[model samples]
Target: MQSKLLAPYEIREMTFKNRVVMSPMCMYAVEKKDGIVTDFHFTHYGSRAVGQVGLIMLEATAVLPEGRISEQDLGIWSDDQIAGLKKLVAHLHKSGAKVGIQLAHAGRKAQVPGPIYSATKLAFSEKYQTPEALTIPQIETVVSAFQKAVKRAEAAGFDVIEIHAAHGYLVNQFLSPLVNRREDQYGGPIGNRYQFLNEIIEAVRSEWTKPLFVRISAEDYAQEGVHLEDYLMMSRWLRDQGVDLIDVSTGGVIPLEAYDVYPGYQVQYADRIRKKVGIATGAVGMITTGNQAEEILRNERADLVFIGRELLRDPYWVKTSAKLLNAEDQLEVPTPYQRGWR
Candidate 1:
C-alpha cells in the first residue's frame, strides 16, 4: 500500500520528509521598482509548505534587476529584500518542510512589456534588435550577482539554492545554438557554451554551503536546438562541479513543433541523465499521478519528482495521493484535518 515516491530521501546534507516538491512557477507578483518580497509571496508559498510538500522552491528569483523574467519577477539584487524573504522561509521551515529559491536571469529575455526573449538578431517573425551582448566584465558582474543572491538566500534561511540554468533563460540562451551567435568564449562549441554555467556554479558554491541544484532541459526539444548528447555532457560537467540534483525539464529554446509530450514524457530524460552523469536528479513536466511518480522512484529513474500545476490545483494533493495509493502513514498533514483522513 505504500509508494516509494511518498517516502523520505536524502541529498547533500539535508533530508526531505518525502519526494513531493513544489516546482518553481512564476507568479509575476513583484512590482517594477521595488524588489522586496511581498506578503502575497509569503502566503502563496507558505500554504504549500503547510500542506506538507517535501520541498518548496520559490519562483525564478532574478539575480539582477534587468535579469527579471518580467518587471514583476522577484529579485535579490539588494540586501534589503532578505528580511521579507526570511519571514516566509521561517514559516516553511517551521511547518517541517524545506525551502529553496530558484536563482535566475532572463538574459536576452530582459526588458519586456511582459516576460519574453529574443536571443538572436532574427526574431520568430517580428523585427527586433539583438541584445547588447554581455561583455566579459558584465558576465563577471552577473556571476557576482549570483554569489550575492546565494549569500542572501542562505541568510534568509533557504535549505537549498537551485540555479535556474535551463528553459531558454540567460544560461540556456548561452548554451543554445539557436540563440547564441557569439564568436567569443561563451559561444561556438559545446564546451564554451557550458563554460558559463560552470562559472556560475563555481561562484555560487563559494557562498552557498547547502545543496546546490542546477535545473536543465534534457533537450531543447528541437532538432536545431541543444541536442541530448551535448545536454548530457553539460550535465556530467555539472555533476563533476558538485551539483546536488539535475532538475530535468525540456523545451524552452524556441518552441516544440513536434514533441510527443504525454504525461511523464520527460521522465525518460531524467533516467537517462542520471545514469549517464551518475548524479541525483529531479524529474518534472506532465507528471501527475502518484502511481506514475512512485514508478519513477521505484525504477530509480529520478531521485525526486516536482509537481507544478497539480499542486496549484490541489494544495493537499499529497495527502490525497498518498491515501489513494494507500500510503497515508508516509506523510503527516495538519492534525486539525486528522478527521478527514480515511
Candidate 2:
C-alpha cells in the first residue's frame, strides 16, 4: 500500500518531502544567554535534517528578552540574530528539509531576571513570580514584538512561522479565561480575549506571506478553563485570518497534577477541530510510532503528525518509521546512508 505518512504535503509555495514534522521543543541551549543560535543548535537540528525529516519546526524562540521562558531561549527580537538563523535554515535546506520557527513569549511563565508580565498579576504557582498585569499600551507593545519577530523570521528564510500560543505562554494566558481576569477590551468575552491574538495575526500577516501556523492548547483540563468549544471558534477565526494550520496541543494552560497519557491521546482534538472548524490541524502528543502516525493521516484525522520525544530519542525516526511501515521506497535516503537503508 502507498504510505500516506511518507507522502509529500504542501502549504502555500513550500512543499514538505513527507508528513513528519519535528515538534517544537525548547532546548534552552543558548550558552551566552544572548538568545542566539549556537553550535549546539546546529548539531542538534542538523541530525534531524540529515535523518530526512520533512519539516523541522524549531523550539519556542522568544520575541523579547523578558519574554524568554529561560535566559538561554533563542531570540529573534533583534536584527542581529538573523545571520545565525539564516545559516541554520540554509543548512537544513541543504539536506532537503523545510525549516520553520515558533515565535513565542513566556508571559507569567518567564523565569528570567526581570519583571514578568501576564494578562493578570497572578503567579503560575507558589514557586513562581507574581507577574504585573499588562496595561493596554503594554499589550500592544507585546503584539508589536511578535510582528517584529516575524520580519526577522522571514529574513532568516524560514518556510513556515508558528505563533507560540500554547503551553501556558503569553498568548495562551490571554486566551484562557482562568488567567485573563481583566475587564478591558482585551479580556472578558471569548471574542475580546481573542482580540490579542487577532491583532498579532494581523500584524504578522502584514509582514509575512508565507504559510503561517498557530499552536493552541485545545483542552485546559480545568473547569471554565479554555476548552475545545472555545478553540473551535477561535480556530475558525484563525483560519479566516489566513492561518494555514492549527498545531493542536493540550494542557499547560493551568498546572495539572496528572492527566490522561496514552498513544494518540491528542489526536481526537486535532480531528475534531479539522472536521468541525474546517481547517488543517497538526496532531501532537504521545503519537510515537509509524503505524500510529499512519493511522492519523490515513483516517484524515490530522494533516501532519508532530513527533516530539520519539524524534528526540531517535534523530532518524523517519528512517525507522519507513522500515516499520515497509515503505523504504518512499524515502530518499541520503547518498551516504543509502547502503545502510538498503
Candidate 3:
C-alpha cells in the first residue's frame, strides 16, 4: 500500500523525496562573533538528512545583525556567510534532502545589545525593553535586507527560500493589528498591514526563481490579532506574489494564549488556507507521528508535513515511522542502516 506521507511532493523545480520536512528550529550554535555555520550545524542537519528527511529548513537566519533573536543565531547579512552555508547545503544534498533557509527579523523579540525594531514601540513583555518603531526609510531598508539575503541564499545553492513572516517576528508584527498601531501606510487596515510583507515577497521574487515559502502565524489566539480567516485573505495575496506554499503555524504574535494543543493542533489552519486560499500549504506544530502526518495528507488537509521537536528528539524518526507504517521500502534507508531495518 502507498502512503501519502512517504510520497514525493513537487513545488516548482524541487521534488521532495517525501512529504516530511524538518521544520527550522533554532540551534543557536554559532561559536564565533560572526554568525557563520560551525561544524555543529553540519553534523546536526546532516544526521537528519541521513535519516531520510525529504526537506530540511535551516533555522531562522537573521537578515540583519540587529534582527537576531539571540547572539548566537545564524546570519546571512554579509557575503562572507555564504561559503559556510553553501557547504552546509552541499552536505545535505549528499544525503538526498532538499535544503531551505528561513530569512527572518526578530523585531521586538530580538534580545540583542542595541535597539530593537517593531511595527509599533510596544515591548513584548515587562522583561523586554520597548522597541523603536521603524520609520518609512527604515522599512525600505528592511525590505532591501531581505532582497540581499535572497540573492545570497541563491548563491548558497538552496533549493528553497522561506520568508519568516510568522511567530511575532518583524513581518508578523507588521501583519497583526494588535502590535501594528501605526496610522501610516504600513498600518491601519489589513491591506495596509500587509504592505511590508507584500514588498518583501516582491523583493524576494525579483532575486529568487525557485520554490518560495512564507511561514505565517495563522491564528494569533487573541481577538484583536490575526485569525485563520485573515490568513486565508493573506494567502490569496501571497499567491498573487508567487509564493508557492504557506508554512502554517499559530500564536506567536503575542504572549502565549490559552489554546488546546494536541497532535496536529495547527493542521486545521493549513487545511483552511489550502482549501479557501487555493494555494498549497504545509501543516506544522505538534505533528509527531507518521500516521498523523499521513492522515493530514490523506484527508487533503495539507501538502506537506513539518516535523519540528519530534525530529530533534529523534533524527531517525522518519525511518522509524516508515517502519511503523509498513512503508519501509518506500523510503531510502542509508546503506549502513539497511541491516537494522531488516
Which candidate has the top score in lDDT?
2
Candidate 1 vs 2: which has more lDDT: 2
Global local distance difference test of model 3: 0.94
**Model 2 collision count:** 0
Worst 10 residues of 1 by lDDT: 120-129
TM-score of 1: 0.94
Cα lDDT of model 2 by residue, 212-257, tens digit: 9999999999988988998999999999999999999998977889
Judging by TM-score against the true structure, name the best candidate: 2
lDDT tens digits, residue span 40-73, model 3: 9999999999999999999999999999999999
The per-prediction tally of clashing pairs is: 0, 0, 0
- TM-score of every prediction relative to native: 0.94, 0.99, 0.98
Candidate 2 stretches greater than 4 Å from native: none
- Model 1: pairs clashing at backbone N, Cα or C within 3 Å: none
Candidate lDDT scores, in order, read 0.83, 0.94, 0.94
Q: List model 1 lDDT by residue over 1-342, tens digit each.
A: 568877788887689999988999998888555677877887888788778899999999988877886778888888888998898899888889999999998876566543343334434323332456677888888888998999899889999999998887888888888888878888888888777888999999888778989988778866678877887888888888889899999877664457677999888889999998899999999888788888899999999999999998888878777877888877786777678764
